[model samples]
Target: MEDVKDYEIKALKKQIFISNLKAWIIGIILVAEIIFIGSFFSKMGTFGEESLSENKVAVVRYNQEVTEEFTTTIMERMDEIKEDETYKSVLFIMGSPGGSPTASEELSEYLKAFQKEMPITMYVDSIAASGGYYIASSIKPLIANKNAIVGSIGVIMPHYNFGQLAKTVGS
Candidate 1:
């Protein structure tokens, strides 16, 4: 009876040790992942408060599709830039296929307001078409590379009659 109790105690102790080790490993991995992601986004010009306080040119990257959420984020960033006097100018780097027209208009208006306060240099490194170009055009000194596409600048509201097409196809 005494020997059996000792064996069970040893088994339980080993299981607890293994569980603790696994938890530590997972915690370390999670911390490492957070650090990696933080560094990655920081490189893409996601400025920290410390960086914003310094005397540096503010960079606003608009690479993703223009939506209301993204437009709001941009507006917030612009407001930050306006508040920070250390920022002498802004570099707006754009690469987008364009998105919501309303969002683009909102961004354009925000940019126009920001430009009035400080200089903004718009750089279209890659494709900036339609709504993207519309927003970019609002800012002065817009620059684009030779190979960079900067046109297809118009809005369209398509009204598709799918029911007629289905009837014609005898669906």
Candidate 2:
């Protein structure tokens, strides 16, 4: 009787151990899947921000501030388009207030060079004014929305002319 009781206890412990092992393996697999899926979505820009497409028509979104990252992304897209034989033409859908004059000039020159090789189109969605307009003008065909604010062909110095305000405060 004593031997039988001991054997039963041992068997229960073995089954419990096996069950716990399976649960641990399942937990690890779940964690790994979560990590893999999260990383994949994040890299593909499905979660935070939409990524610039390489093979298809590249969509470059510019807001108030355009950073080096944006410029780099544009350059990368241009390179990809140059390499890809599937795309016959490239288009710049502009929706920007404006940006760095240097970046704008660089982008304009790049587009002009690209247009030399293949057909390029510029379509302004909302307001492609100032530097934005500068870039758009380089392209062959420029199209703007009916109510879109366009054209600001000039340079702006970053100096505040507050002489009148100072005089008023003194008086």
TM-score of each: 0.62, 0.56
| Per-model C-alpha RMSD | 10.2, 7.5
Candidate 1, 42-157: lDDT as tens digits: 75557454442356788899998888898899889888988988788999998888999999998999889878889999999997998899888898899998899998977787
Each model's lDDT comes to 0.87, 0.77
Tens digits of per-residue lDDT for model 2 on 59-99? Answer: 44554443456766887888887787656677778877677
Q: Could you tell me the C-alpha RMSD of candidate 1 in Å?
A: 10.2
**Residue 27 CA error for candidate 2 (Å)?**
25
| Backbone N/Cα/C clashes per model | 0, 0
What candidate 1 gets wrong by more than 4 Å, as runs, is: 1-55, 160-171
